[model samples]
Target: MWWYTFAHVVYHLIRWFPKNNRLKIRIVIVLFSFGLLFPQLFVLSREHSTRYCGQHLFDFLIVSIVFTFFMIGFSFIFSLMDPVPWEVKLAFHIFGVIAFVMGLTLTVFASLAVDCRNNTLELYYLSVSAAVLTVTSFAFLMVMIPFWLLNYFFPNSVLNRKERTGVCYEPTACCSCLWHI
Candidate 1:
């Protein structure tokens, strides 16, 4: 669908967020999260509630979708920030991978729990999967919080010029808007 195409374009452009633009990165993350999350909320809300639990579970799915979407979008930025400390980059990547694995686990569990054709929910197992997904998403966000704050305040990043291998590129409006072009 158009979602896949939009994500593909974002995946390509996110890599261009300069290593020094930690502030920009943080801002973009917030904005992107907001843009995607709200539309998802509206759509999910329009979906009929088969049961209270089912409605809630669907909301849970929306949360998982939003966080996973942001993580995937930011994966490119984290990978390209060569000027960042190894510790920071390693931490983000490790947590990101864990989030992905847990998300996959949740998806498989959810699918197995739902009898789509019958329009029935295996309430127990689906709830369990949602719980697991929630915990993983919470952990991932916690890990990212420190990094985002550091970047927001420092603007430069976790390392100085002498420690990193290459110069960090400063984001300019035009350069950062390569996605638009």
Candidate 2:
């Protein structure tokens, strides 16, 4: 459920990113500031939190901030590909979710491994699962790569009936719904 919401928010943010100069500048400034202070903040948080629960809370806070920064960077980078279709952007967002999940699983496994040394086999299994997810995420990208290549290599194969008027008269089923909205 949260994934759906986050994806929706990211999609809209990407949609707006190319149009908003002020947002672009602000995002760049925020990213720069966070990059400078993140290491210090993370080290300080780790030193101050003695309790396991408090340490976990700090970890969560830091992870969330880093994830936000990552999303902004992701959107900014994708927005730079101005000629790309919206469907491709959506695909990239889905790819990002898969990658994020893989990363999260690995982080959990790493964090728990030290405390649960007796469960060495279980941690190995978790590591294997994360590896599987990593493969699956890239597999998704591999599937999309051919289509992107086709689009790039044969741009004229895709029809744009009303290029000047910014209208697609013969929209495909996938794009028709988006066009109406």
Using lDDT, give the best candidate's number: 1
For model 1, residues 1-181, the per-residue Cα lDDT tens digits are 1222233344445556665665666567557656655544454554442344433456555545665465555544544555557786565556556655655555555555544323433443444545554565556556556755776687657423345421123332326342321
Q: How far is each candidate from the true structure, as Cα RMSD in Å?
A: 11.9, 10.2
**On residues 63-93, what C-alpha lDDT tens digit does candidate 2 reach at each position?**
5445545554554555455556878667666
Q: Using TM-score as the measure, which candidate wins?
A: 1
Question: How well does candidate 2 match the true structure, expressed as C-alpha RMSD?
Answer: 10.2
TM-score, predicted candidate 2 vs. hidden true structure: 0.33
What lDDT score is found at residue 179 in candidate 2? 23
The residue ranges of model 2 lying beyond 4 angstroms of the native Cα positions read 1-13, 16-72, 76-132, 159-171, 174-181
